[model samples]
Target: MNVTLFSKPDCKQCDFTKRGFDKHGIDYVTVDVTADDSGRQKCIDLGYSSMPVVLVESGQEIVHWSGFRMDEIKALAYLEGAPQ
Candidate 1:
């Protein structure tokens, strides 16, 4: 299972999103779009303009969302059959 979070520095929403993931004990890889070129390109490729883009990928299950969405976060956090 892989969880990726697209974020940037000095972003309040990004901080909120990260804190939420931490609080929920959801391990994830954070991609700083403002720091890395590849990360910025990925955000563009994914058609995302928000600060925190959460992507939960595991085999056939590939779900993603932009900004701070607690509902989505909780869903991914409690997803069954997902490999930790």
Candidate 2:
């Protein structure tokens, strides 16, 4: 499974998302939308119009969402074989 977090600077929701992932021991890659135009465009292309966008890929399944979602983060922990 692979996780990608698209976020911008000075975003509280993004910070909360990251903290949630950290607390759950979930490893992920971060795409800075503010610093990376292509990343931002990718988020827009994915139909996300928000600051923090999370993309999760596992085998043939792909999941994505926007905003600070601790529930999603916890779900990821379970999916990734981490303690909830």
Candidate 3:
């Protein structure tokens, strides 16, 4: 599984998301939306008006969401059939 976190500076939700991932030991790539126009465009394209967006890619499946979703994070941390 590949995880990408799209975030901006000084975003509390982004900080929470990063801390959650860190606490769960989930390695993810960070994309700074403020630093890159393309990254910011991605958030807009995804129809998100939030600070932090999480994109997850597992094989042929791709999932994405915005905000600090601990439920989703927990599910990702303990996904069935995923390599442990």
Candidate 4:
């Protein structure tokens, strides 16, 4: 499963969220909105007018959290292993 995190540099919440993902050993791609125009557009395209948005592989969004909740993220990640 792919996890995409859209964030900007110097964002404390973004740093905190990344740390949670790292602690969980989850592999995710980070998109720095300030560094890439396209990345910023992508975040806007998702209807998120804020930073630190997380997109799960199944097209579900777990966003707008001040900090990453491990249990919620893990539950979403575990959905990848759910039987169809």
Candidate 5:
């Protein structure tokens, strides 16, 4: 499983979300919208017009959402065998 966080530097929710992942020891790659044009377009293409977008991939399935979804992250961390 792979988790990617799409965020800009000024987004507090994005920082909070990343902190949550760190707290649970969940590994993820962050894509900065203000810098990465292609990555930013992808985030926009995923039906998210906001920062703090998260894309989750498990096997051939990919899912995405925006905001600080703690409950969802917890489940994803477990699915990825992250230390709880």
Candidate 6:
């Protein structure tokens, strides 16, 4: 399953989310909304004004947390059939 993470720089939650993904050995593509206008527009299109929006492979939103929630993410990953 593919994971798409929409994040912004200097976001502590974003960093923590990355750590969680690393711990799970999950491969994901991160799009920095602050650095890229297109990425920012994507976030807007998704109706998210905050950073660290996580998109799962099934077109479901696993997380839209302003802060990192490792356990929640882990559960969502498992439900999505992603590797732990």
Q: Which residue segments of model 4 deviate by more than 4 Å? A: 59-71, 80-84
TM-score winner among the candidates?
Answer: 2
Model 2 stretches astray by more than 4 angstroms: none
- Sort the candidates on lDDT, descending order: 2, 5, 3, 1, 6, 4
Candidate 6, residues 1-84, lDDT tens digits: the string is: 667788988999899999888777777899998788987887788787888877666556344444577876797667756677
List, in order, the clash count of every candidate structure: 0, 0, 0, 0, 0, 0
lDDT of 5 by residue, 18-68 (tens): 999998888899999999999899987988888899998878999888999
The TM-score of candidate 4 is: 0.73
TM-score of 1: 0.87
Best by lDDT: 2
TM-score (C-alpha) between model 2 and the true structure: 0.95
**Model 6 segments more than 4 A misplaced:** 59-67, 79-84
lDDT string for model 4 (1-84, tens) is: 677888988888788778877766767899898898997887778777777878766446444332455665666546644321
Query: So what's the TM-score on candidate 5?
Result: 0.92
Better of 1 and 6 by lDDT: 1
Error of 1 at 84 (Å): 16
Segments of candidate 1 deviating more than 4 angstroms: 80-84
RMSD of each: 2.9, 0.7, 2.5, 4.6, 1.0, 2.8
Q: What TM-score, over all chains together, does every model reach?
A: 0.87, 0.95, 0.90, 0.73, 0.92, 0.76
lDDT score, residue 33, model 4? 86
Clashes of 3: 0
Worst 10 residues of 5 by lDDT: 75-84
Report the C-alpha lDDT of model 1 over 1-84, residue by residue, as the tens digit. 899998999988889889877877888999888888888787778888778887778999778788888777777767743333
